[model samples]
Target chain A: MIKLEIKLMKNILGANDEIAALNRKLFAERGVVVMNLMGSPGSGKTTLLEKTLVRLVDKIKIAVIEGDLFTAKDAERIERAGVEVIQINTAGGCHLDAAMIQKACTSLDLNAIDLLIVENVGNLVCPAEFDIGENFKAVVLSITEGDDKPLKYPLIFKESEVTLLNKIDLLPFTNFDLRSAREDLITLHPTIKIFETSCTGGTGLEDWCTWLLQKVAR
Target chain B: MHEATLAENILNIALEAAKQNQAAKIFKIGLTLGEMAGVEVEALTLSFDVLKKNTPADGAELAIKRVPISAVCNKCGKIFQLESYNFFCPACDGILILQSGRELLVDFVDCE
Candidate 1:
């Protein structure tokens, strides 16, 4: 004898989204602007973040929640920049979901914090699928990466509110086709803002900073 | 790499449901995997096989339903499934933003 149950097949994402919504409400009430920074492992996410922290340390209180496979080095770098930082080692996990973020938030002082930057584990695929209760998703695509990245991984490009084309200083050296990259991304996401910057050279960084400040104001 | 974790989640959900319904054995479990879920079905199946050995769901059959890639046209506000990698709307050359292809769900269970 066997019984068949016809469940509605609710979205498995429901759990993660519910936690994300809660985090959003908490952020709104506390006037905190949370940014979900996503990119590949070597896309210069931490380097760009370090630059941002250097510029905004005097104006606004910032905190960082670093997600990694197995290291506290990034958290240490952020801590040395004179701000509160928490490191989440996913162990073998590919992405950081809202529940993990909620646990990390318990250690930070949300009252005094104006911005909370959650650096997701460096992976384009899984991170984009998980909602970590962020106001917006910011992606970093270094020029060193292939120009076909946007076409290969369309989800990250489509889901991102802002895309940072990092490592512009190396553009001259690499055979990266900028025109095709922009065209491919525009085909997927027309409204997404694209920024060209190099954390190493400090080129085209003001735009990213301005964008960050604007989001914090809202 | 994350197959072990995903398998654990699946087993947890199945066991909880089985306990609620007083099921002596689980017959089958249904899963919906989206196109862009970033999870490998083969790896998941392999993980389930190894992890379910001697467990409550030891003999349970796993059935997978794949979700197709879909997008919504920004200009026309129309949703359609993509048969290929092209992201442009066929009716119009408007950019199509992704609306699906990232689902991961455990839809139903068979118990006795």
Candidate 2:
């Protein structure tokens, strides 16, 4: 009896999927390309956005919805980067859900923005469960975080459309097995686009930027 | 930590399903939480108890199924269960790509 009950407990995700579909439709109508940037804390997600803002802010009107457990620091940084930014302080929340993101969207001028980047609260697990009305999910993995990360957190790697292996500049200092990580990631998600980047040194930004531009344009 | 929110989502889904089926009472709410889901089962149960009070699903039992983390190794082509935080195959130190078991879903419902 217990085994049967457990086996039937598989449809809960369908509920979340329904909500996500509705969100996807709403975003499409507005021509807003939403990217959910997910990563462990200190994976250089904000830094990448900051650097992008310096280069692309003039051409593409970008807005960010920063999800953090505490503090308005990230939002402030983006604001200074010359883009419309809103911060959703989840307090102790681990992930940013669609409901919370929908509320955040109200504060932005959606009509003027081409891209809406949601920097999800630094988590690889919980964030993958919730869809924050995004076109695609992006995962940032620092080389310092270990190459074994892709295998340990395969869901994030599989769910994400693009994986940014950030902090490559630190590879020389650390024993991060980049080849193994890429191989692991590719095995799980055959089509996932992997970008090697260092947000601090600005290496491999051009490829990432090009990918973002083409994706958003579509 | 976020188990409370997940419990809320479960209740929301149960309530919606109850409404959809026009069932007077929800007998059971089922869930499949994967091993790698990062959700604490104890936290979910505690949150469910608190949130279920006064709702139609108050007495409705929550059935949570735990799935083992199983992956297929790219190098060895062998299926094996993962141990601890290790996500690599023990046979050949190959990438253990998740094949199944990480099922965060509500498969069915028992209503009357």
Candidate 3:
């Protein structure tokens, strides 16, 4: 057998990207806006979703696709908020891929939904790399995670269009430098919209919901 | 992080390429990974080794070239290598837009 080199410059993430594009097309065709909510574990993504749904459900139709490593706990919480939700258990997978999101999208009624929030598996690194065909990628970083996180996980900060500085109510108890975090995040992504949020204290839910409403309206 | 999944995709792509070339065995696979690709080289290599077994692309060596992270200044448009992981322009102090840091691809395959 003769050794031969076949030049094939194919992207490794092509399959996932293709599927994500399909999802994006589907959402656009149905006049639905999708946001891929990403963050580290315990970044208060679920709580924020619950609070956002509570504020905006009466205004527009919203649904959720909850992603977790195991258990349907988050889906249950979203269900309690009176929103149609589907849980995707990756078992031990680090992040949710476009194929998984596409499968989850099947369970939802696309025509009835104005907005679809895909709560990605709570991971900072891997989740940032995969696009789930959402209109925007929003990341939540708690004050407790420290200000250096934007530098440590540049991809998440850079990829996201919005940053929810969650757990702001606990700012006084922790050494998290809110200013430095904001500066670093802005440096990484100059156009990124930021919000200081406290789910427990209900600090910035109103503004955040208002922003979401605007996106759905657009 | 998702290097294992990436390894699988690489293997499958290599297998397909080998078949297209009408080669019975894959010898080496050329992969290009960026610094900001969020993939560990060691982990991806290990995963590829484990998955290549019992496949048409068995015992294939992955020749991976890691591309360094770089960005272009949004204001001045000066491109520079991001050695310190800082996303700011040194010349104009402008916000640097990422140029080519986040890429993972199968460049080519050598087969027989």
Chain A TM-scores, per candidate, are 0.97, 0.93, 0.98
Put down candidate 3 lDDT per residue, B18-70, tens digits, no spaces: 98889998989999999888888899999999999998788789999989988
Model 2 chain A is weakest, by summed lDDT over 10 consecutive residues, at A1-10
Model 3, A1-218: lDDT tens per residue? Answer: 79899999999989899999998999999999999999999999999999999999899999999999999999999999999999999989999999998898788889999999999998898888888889999999988888899889988888899999999999999998888888888877888999999988999999999998999899
Query: Which residue ranges in model 2 land beyond 4 Å of their true spot?
Result: A1-19, B15-28, B33-43, B49-61, B65-103, B107-112
Docking quality category of candidate 3 according to DockQ thresholds: medium
lDDT of all predictions, in order shown?
0.86, 0.82, 0.90
Off by over 4 Å in 1: A6-8, B84-88, B93-99
Cα-based TM-score, every candidate: 0.92, 0.79, 0.96
Scanning candidate 3 chain A in windows of ten residues, the lowest lDDT window is A182-191
Q: Write candidate 1's Cα lDDT for A158-213 as tens digits.
A: 78999999999998899999999888887667778999999978988888898899
Could you say which candidate leads in DockQ?
3
Off by over 4 Å in 3: none
Question: Candidate 3: what lDDT?
Answer: 0.90
Put the candidates in DockQ order, highest first: 3, 1, 2
lDDT of 2 by residue, A74-172 (tens): 999999998888999998899888778777877777878899899999987789877666889999999889999887877788789999999999999
